[model samples]
Target chain A: MSITEIIIISLIKIVIVLGITLITVAYLVYFERKIAAWAQNRIGPNRVGWQGILQPFADVFKLLLKEDIVPERANRIVHAIAPMIALFVAFTTYAVIPIGPNVNIFGYDISLVVADVNMGVLYVLALTSLGVYAITFAGWSSGSKYSLLGGIRSSAQMISYEISMGFSIGGVLLLAESLRPIDIVNSQTNLWNAIVQPIGFITFVVSAFAETNRLPFDLPEAEPELVGGFHTEYSSMKFAGFFLAEYANMVIASAMIVTLYLGGWHLPFEQSLGLSGIWLTVAQIASFFVKMGAMLFFFIWVRWSIPRFRYDQLMNLGWKVMFPLSLINIIWVAAIIMIFN
Target chain B: MSQTSNSLKKRKKDLTFWQKIYIPEIAKGLALTFKNMVRPKFTMEYPEEKFIPPPSYRGRPVLVLEETGEERCVACGLCSRVCPALAIEVQAAETEREKERYPEKFEINMLRCIFCGLCEEVCPEEAIVMSKDYELAFTNREDAIYGKDKLLTPVSQLEDRIEFLRKYK
Candidate 1:
């Protein structure tokens, strides 16, 4: 492809991805409220615009109009930049996640992903780890006990959980024998990783919850203990950035889970229907999103249903339980591959 | 520790291998929540659909206007004396009626009123009773202190509550 053409294509992809991510994040919050209401036998937001469809917009506008208050003793530069870093990391990680198979678009073959890097998985892991820095910076810079403790808790929780998460991913990596997410998705055409390795899937899902700082693993922002946690001092748009980042990270986690274990865009027994060209690609992408949506629902469902684990219990589970289970999963995968091959 | 020390029989049952796995329990919980998601929502959309409180429901307090368009209050100040929140302010005036007295100025601070139904209970003439106007919103303190203009309701509107009070009280 020519330089300008490549630039144009990249720009288009960036815009499309960012737009979709933002909109999805907004609706995710709405659905979270709705589902929570249903589970608890209460009416959710439905007054603003046709069952609260415009609720998220109203929320954004309200946040924008609010005063951006910074703590008197806060490190102004770092405190301001923390949420931006979090937002940046959350959105950028979506670049390598393949939403669908390649398709011929106006004569040029285009992959659905923004970037098809060879080490896409590694890039994702790296970016997610950098997300910790944002939390830590927010906590430390805020110069408040609550924010500082929240930041400290988040870093500790993430690091411990990430170990188990990485080990669980090892089983999938062993099977695919490639770090490229597209290749991993292609390998799952016959058998999904979740089916072959249930243990790893469970641990990975748990770790993903902790990584996203969701409820049941949401000790960092446990309102009873930490107030608003790391973002306690943040108000207005700065707070919104962290809020957006958290939801966006949930999206990325769901997408990753779908791509890794649920066979990504590949659907079973679609050959009989014989979809061709653009139609086939569209079907593939739709399948991927459906899987992702199911994961997202599960995330929210688990959040509302289960109570958060105690801090000591959380550490014990991460180190004593998940870490070992993931290691065993790797061994089990290795044995299965050897026996079969 | 306290629970464990209380009684041997109160101890948690030793978890079986299957129970220890916890997957089944998690699945059960997930199934329950999923079932709830599809179940009928108990949401009552307010404003659009106001709930008609039953006859026994105690809502805002109002003075009862009789069939003759005259208030039943004797201006004895029993309601004012009984109001725990000091919500009701009654000024008695000499009247030419059979009761010989009436409230010249009757006011109830909606904000101060705790909806305890004490004033209604204390009214000797069955003059003041709770009405079904539960949607009481006031933007200012002045607006909240409802005078006779806001508190007086036609006897017909509170007949059910009146009937209920007569039967039960």
Candidate 2:
């Protein structure tokens, strides 16, 4: 494809992906509420639309109409930039995720992915690490002691977990023998890495929770104590940006899980399913979504079922426990691979 | 010997750097939490699933009547006088033919009633008592101010007591 053609295709893909992500994020909130209500034997949002499915849209409308307030003493530039950075980094990670294989579009062959980089895993890791900057900036720029403390705590928590996260991915990289996500899936032709690298899988799952600031590890934004945490000063679209980033991060994390461990888009024993055309690509995209939805549900389940951890306990878990276990897992995996080879 | 003993006391068994790392403990904690997340939640579904109130629970106040269709209260005004919260108000009227005292009007401001059950305890003839109607919610102030007719129990339930009172007299 020519430069212009590639640019046009990329823009189109971006628009489609972003539109779907925004809509999905809205529904994910509604889904979370419904699941929570079901678990608690209460009626969740049912008045807005059919079974309250439109409730998240209604919420978005309300948030958009609400006043955007900036504190007088706050650093306005950083305050505005923080959530955008978070949201941008989150959305950017989706570029390399292969929803499906190649297909013929208007007599031209096109891949479903936006960018198929050799360092897809590293790119995702980089984007996820950058997500902390937004939180930290929001906290420090707010000029409030609470926001500052929250930012510091969030950065510390994320950094601690990131180490273990890197180690977990190291195991997957070793098993796959390639840093490219597509290659990783291709490597898992016989069985998913999840079966072989159970310990690494556990580490990755737990680290993902901490990295995204989900419940149990969601102490940085603990409402009762921090009073809105790092984004306490943000309002209107800026606040919504942070909200979008959170849900988007959740989506990205789910995608990573599907890609890394669940054998991304590779259905087992499907050598003759005739999924080579557009239909195959569509099915792959659908499978990716199903896997993501399951992971997202698991995220919500953990959130509603458990209480937030204390800051000390969270730090203890990340540094003292998860870090060492990941290291041990790495060693174990290396030993096994060596012995088998 | 003294120096050796001091050294021994000072050389406390500090956790090895590896033990201090806490990876296994966190794994255990994660397992426990994950197990809890999958476990069945204990939830109480309200409305359709009602909770059984305790036996001694005091609810709304109701008035009692005699079998001869006479109000059980003889207008002694004891319930009104003894009520610490002064929630109950009673007025007496002399019957034209019998020249006997009967309550002309009875009103209980539930808004003011502290639900101490003092009025029911103080009723000399057991004429007033609290009933098991705790689902008492009102949209208006007027609705909350329960008067004589609304405060009284159904006539069918009071009929037996009223008949017994008439037979004894």
Candidate 3:
């Protein structure tokens, strides 16, 4: 491809990914509410549209119209930039998560990812770590005690969990021998990383929940203690920015989980079925979405089922349990590699 | 320190190996909620489907209107006197009818009405009773102060409450 062609293709991919991520984030909120209501044996929102399908748009409009209040003591510039940082971190991390193998489109070969970078895994880790700054800045700049406390809790929680998360990924990188996301997915063709190293999968998932600030690990946004936590002082579209970023992060987390552990778009037993060309590519892509959807559902289901962990318990679990488990997982993977290779 | 710690001590049940692992326990909880997700929802979807409150329910208070279009209240001030919230006002006037007296002006300030059933309980005439009209909304104080016209319910519509009162009260 020429320079212009490559630029156009990359732009098209970026637009598509952004659009899909935004739409999915909106619907994910709707489904989260619906699933929560279902878990409690009550009807969820249904007034906006059929089974509340259009509720997300209504929510966006409502948020857009709300007054953006800034506190008298607030650091205005940092407060304004916090949500933007969150959104940027969330959306940019989705760039390297390959959803499908290369496919032929109008005689042009195209890969189904926004940017196929060499150190995609490292990029994702770096960007997600930057997400901590978004919350911390929001908390500190808000000039509210609740926001500050939330920021402090979030910084602590994220740093601790990220350790286990990194180690868990270490097991996968050991087998794949590449930091590239596409290469990791390709390595899982024979057996998914989840099956090979169950401990790492579990630790990674728990860390992902903590990283995304989902319930059971949502100590930062502990409603009772810290009110809206890091977002206590935020309102209107700025608040919605944080909300969108959280869900978008969830999408990225699940996509990364899929890419690293669940074999990405490679359907098992596809060789025996003898699917070829365009049909095979289509099936593979669909399979990737199905895996992602299931993971997303599990995330929602767990949120409603489990209560938030106490701060002390959370720290203990991260350090005492998850860290050790992930380390063991690395050793287990090394053993498997030694035996097999 | 030991005494205080002993006082604050909890009887903690030691978890088995499987329970301590946490995964199986979490799976059990997930399974339970999944079952509930498929179970019948209890939501009434208000406005579309109204709840038929049981006769025992204490909602807004109403005066019973007889079949002959006469009010069952014989200018009784007992309800007004017994109301803890001082929500009800009744002005008695001489009447040519067999009851000999009737409420000339009756007003219930719903804003002050606590729905305690005190007015209903104190009514000797079985005239005032709690109705199932719980959906009360008002823009102003004047609108919230329900007059005799707003308070009166037909005898047939109030049969459930009256019968319940007769058997239980």
Separate DockQ for every predicted complex: 0.71, 0.12, 0.87
Q: After superposition, how far is residue B43 of candidate 3 from its true place, in Å?
A: 0.9
Clashes per candidate (backbone, < 3 Å):
0, 7, 0
lDDT of 3 at A294: 92
- CA lDDT of B47 in candidate 3? 93
Model 2 docking tier (incorrect/acceptable/medium/high): incorrect
Residue A301 lDDT (model 1): 98
* lDDT of every model, 2 decimals: 0.92, 0.82, 0.94
Give the per-residue lDDT of model 2 (tens digit) for B1-169: 9999878666544655554544565556546655654566555456667765543556777787655666677777988888888888899888765638878888888888888777767777778766666787889888878887887675565444345434543
Using all chains and alpha carbons, the TM-scores for the candidates as numbered come to 0.94, 0.80, 0.95
C-alpha positional error of residue B87 in candidate 2 after TM-score superposition, expressed in Å: 2.0
Quick one: best DockQ, which candidate?
3
- Leading candidate by lDDT: 3
Looking at model 2 chain A, report the run of 10 residues with the lowest lDDT sum: A269-278
Q: Provide the lowest-lDDT 10-residue window in model 3 chain A.
A: A269-278
Model 1 clash pairs are none
How high a TM-score does candidate 3 get?
0.95
DockQ (model 1, Cα): 0.71
Q: Give the lowest summed-lDDT range of ten residues in model 1 chain A.
A: A269-278
